[model samples]
Target: MAEKKFESDAKRNERLYVLYYIFGAMFIILLGALAYRQIFMYGYYHKKGMLQTQRRIIQPGARGDIYDRNGRLIVGNRPVFDAVVYFNDARFDFRKEYARLNKLRKQNKEPFDYSKLAIAARTNVLQSYIDEINSILKTDFVLDADFNRHFSGRQLMPLPLVKNLSISQHAILAEKLRVDNSAVQIYTDTYRYYPYADRAAHAVGYIRPEIEQVDPDIPGDDLRTFSFLGKIGKSGVEKAFEDRLAGETGAEIWVVDHNGFTFEKIESKPPRKGGSMQVSLDMELQGAIEDAFPNRKGAAVALDVKTGEILAMVSRPSYDPNTFFPTMTHAIYNDIRDRGAWLNRATQGLYPPGSTFKIITALAGIKSGVIGPDTVSYCDGYYQVGSRKFPCHNRYGHGEVNLQQAIEKSCNVFFYEHGQKMGIDSIAKTAKEMGLDSPTGIELHEESTRLTIVPTPEFKRKQGSGWSKGDTANVSIGQGDLRQTPLQMACFAASLARGETRTKPSILHDTTRKTDMKYHGAKKLDIPKSGYDAVIEGMVNAVERGTCRRAAIDGVKIAAKSGTAQVMVKGRKLTLAWMIAFAPVENPEIAAAVIVEGEEPGDASGGATAGPIMREMFAEYFKGRQVAQ
Candidate 1:
């Protein structure tokens, strides 16, 4: 039994010995393979790296210019210098390289003291080495905290230390870099700026520092890896045509040495400049209108009746677009964002139409034959319909008045009855046909308007309610839920004047290149001349001796209507004053609408607030009149 056990132990030992030898051979082979790769691969890369070292300087392309119809420069670029860092090109162990400096300060001579040194003292370090560098550089080289966060994620890209550096600063950077060629490098680029300042800010828009969109043509393979892209328009025409305005950015190959110092070459594809935009804005007329609203808070839109060109569109409480370029700090943004400023009231703001909406009631009453030109409604300060009593604007009422007289005096009682007779459905349909309750479809973004139709079964399903006559009466008189933008009012007024369904208006008269606008669905519209004529006479009387008396321009018989509409925000009632009109009664050329909010006197009417601005715009617009220029 002892001999058999010894034999089993020998066999076990032999198997263990063979397994150990095999393991040793495999380990040595793996080590040798790693060594070979370390030598061969590193050798090839290191050699090529020598021929291709560089400072990794980057260039942001120039921003495009914006021109008005008259070819005047409304927006342009100014040269700016920036303090930037090329992280990948920064030599020395950024972590440890500075470590020795701090250590040296403890005992030995400090080799490089960036912190103790003044801004100029440190401008000549890292990638560049020259005398001229110091002379031209105006900014300090110390990295900022915000920059550090960006650099970590954007290691491959150069960091901008300062943006929109002034002209004097640019001069300093250029001269210094030329003379010294120091360690710190200067990057020059164009920053977006607006010459018009606030004149057309709402239309021209602004830009941000970081690019928001990469080229849509980027390949699937590279898209995931690319970290930064170019600018995006945030609002107005700027946002609407972002693709054309953002332009393109190019890429280059960067190589570095062990020190992470840039010492090689750069090969880059040149970036494509953005396209120039010719806005349909009438600078002269825009300026004139802007001049009219020096202090008042309001907006105005003047339309070309023969064609749908917006002659002038001015949103008051204007902000300098220059504030938005490069970057808009929280403080500056908050200052302008919702301060009743920034809002393009002409195209997007919805207001109660007041007496201006009486035309629609008249049209509905006329069309439905429920009320006639000769039909009379007595307004003894108030109107009675169902369980509701509506008041007339005169307070004492016009007593007994015809449809024309009711419109002339803007009698609310008449419209309240008209709303009851026409009902909500008929009023809604007529209002829609007259260009209310829908977006004017102006080029501006998210243009808002009121819904004319009362909530139907479908609307009820969505809103969880059935239609009511009271609601109908409310909307018909441009109260309750009835709202229309200044642009919509002008468009509808133009329709009433032209008798053809011309579109509301356009920011770009020459839309040959704007593919999106090519299919906007503009078509010829046919409506009964008598229906238009009836509305026209009412508007004419409105201007001759009615609510729109403020809009009367001497030498031109203005057919205008004014409205003092009630607006409620968060259930608090306020009045939004408005006026819509067309001029040169014999041959109409201009259609104008102005809306004013926050006017004093809760009883403030559109005729009082918007009328004068419209009158002023027309006086100047047609001062040197001729057959359509």
Candidate 2:
């Protein structure tokens, strides 16, 4: 019995040993799992999340440059350095940082002055950062409210380092950005700049923030890629050649760190730099023309009388366009807006051609053979048309004047007599053919118009006013239904010089785009050479010895006409000054038109206001040229 008990106890001892071994193995496994969890799972993941994100720096494509006919830079883009903050790269432990700073302050003997300490701390931080930056770069960084604003709003986004950097500085920054792989990065951002802003602001209009994405007519590229980029031209030549001035935008892959910092970059495409623009403008002439006006609002356009290429266009009271790039403030914008300073008055504003329209009437009369160059008309100080007596501006009638004398003296009766003979329809038709009733297609924004000549019953139905013969008589002298722009007047003078009726006036001249010069199935207006010559001679006489006597140039002979259109505002008559001139008399090279509005209620005339501007322009331009031998 004892031996059997011993055997059972031995078997039980062996089972107990196996069970002990199994329990010891399980405990060792559990302890290893706990150690692994404590060392590498949750804690490791959090540390991994704390690492700053690295993003690849993206380069913005440059906008094209704008130049004059001589390739002088009119408008261009300049680089600027801006401090940029990568939100994702920024440390997010603001509370912990505040606590640490508080501990540092307490450890020192500094008093509890939170405001002063906070300011000093911020300044110290900025200074330290700038100092470190200066260590790498040999330039200084300025800290201002703009940085504060960006910091308060977007700590992750990078702030501008420097604005309005020079080309040399831009080169330095670009080279540093490409070569250096430091933790902090700086890149170049270009802003629109106008070097000759005073010279061609009206012709090369300013830019504004576009409301949305700009899509070009060209295929193979998406304009949306530049949705956050610089804008194209908005007005004048800039607006006209916006497509050319704005190049295709390219994009790249930017790998960012956890804190949104720039890391490695993969270029998706190399952005195509925009092409430069060359306009048909002479900067010297433009400056001379702008200097011609003094303290008055006016416009002048000079066109190559032979080629229809615009040389210079001046609009007075023009706003400077240098403030348009990057962004503009409401105060500055409203200052320009309230004064109508930004309006391109030359092409967009309309006014009466005044006495200048008499040339058309003379042509119409001579073309109808109803009156000759020697046609005579007598005025008794005032001519009676039906029941109304129309007074000449002379206040005393120009009596017994022939067409040449009438043109030289601008006698209203000669034109009235001829207008009566030829009828108003003939004059309207002739003027329309001279590029009047529509836009001249000048590549600039314009508001062109046609007169309501002899408003028929159908016209009366459309408009509330009925046709009146008195209106037709007024239209004959450029009064009742007469309106034309300074650019249109310039174009008209150019047509007379070129001797053909094609008009394509513009300040922009792009070699890439071909100009359609043919008038395109347009009707031609025929006039007698004798009549045209007589009137042109009369214009020459006027400039030489009449109302526009002040417009004489030393070397070149300028055939010119003056206009003083009357406007009735609140029962008061206001005169708008006007002048149109073409130089060299026989073979004109340039033609110009100028106008100034809101004259002191009939206190000013075209000869006194607009004509003198032409004189100033001529005096400066014809400085040493020889016209008469």
lDDT of 1 by residue, 88-132 (tens): 545432544555445756676645556553222223333233222
Clashes of each: 29, 31
lDDT of 2: 0.69
- In candidate 2, clashing pairs total 31
Q: Across residues 161-208, which tens digit of lDDT does each residue of candidate 2 receive?
A: 555555665566556655654334554666788887667688888666
Cα lDDT, all candidates: 0.67, 0.69
Instruction: Please state the error at residue 278 of candidate 2 in Å.
Output: 1.1
User: Which portions of model 2 show Cα errors greater than 4 Å?
Assistant: 1-59, 87-157, 161-186, 209-228, 257-263, 446-461, 510-525, 620-623
